[model samples]
Target: MKTVYFVVLLLVALTYFTTIEASAIPHCSPWRCQQECLFKNFMKGECIQLQCVCSQKIGGIRP
Candidate 1:
């Protein structure tokens, strides 16, 4: 009986911790992408297809 109770408690604790960790992950957005690009000194930043794309000029020309 004690073993079974311990197992259940452990499972509950594990589930709670896992959920907290999952929710702690940062969600990527267009604004986040732009801020990240600006920090990296990029010319422009845009989010495309849920991905961050940074553009930088090369030799006075845009690529």
Candidate 2:
């Protein structure tokens, strides 16, 4: 009961911040791609930021 209300309030606040304006990406890697990248999800706006990457090498010797 009370806990649910609190959670709703918190979500509202977050929505206001992420909706009213935009925020910057955090340092030390996020959750999406590696390096530095901005990810936008639907009209909801860029809510969650990610910094996950995978390294792969291509063969240079191709006939």
- Residue 3, model 2, lDDT: 100
Model 2 whole-model lDDT (C-alpha atoms): 0.48
For residue 21, give model 1's deviation from the true position in Å: 8.8
lDDT of 1 at 29: 81
Residue-level lDDT tens digits of model 1 in 1-63: 999999999999999888998678655588888888888778778977657888984345457
Show model 1 residue runs off by greater than 4 Å.
1-27, 58-63
Q: What TM-score does candidate 1 reach?
A: 0.45
Query: Estimated TM-score per prediction?
Result: 0.45, 0.34
Q: Pick the candidate with the highest lDDT.
A: 1
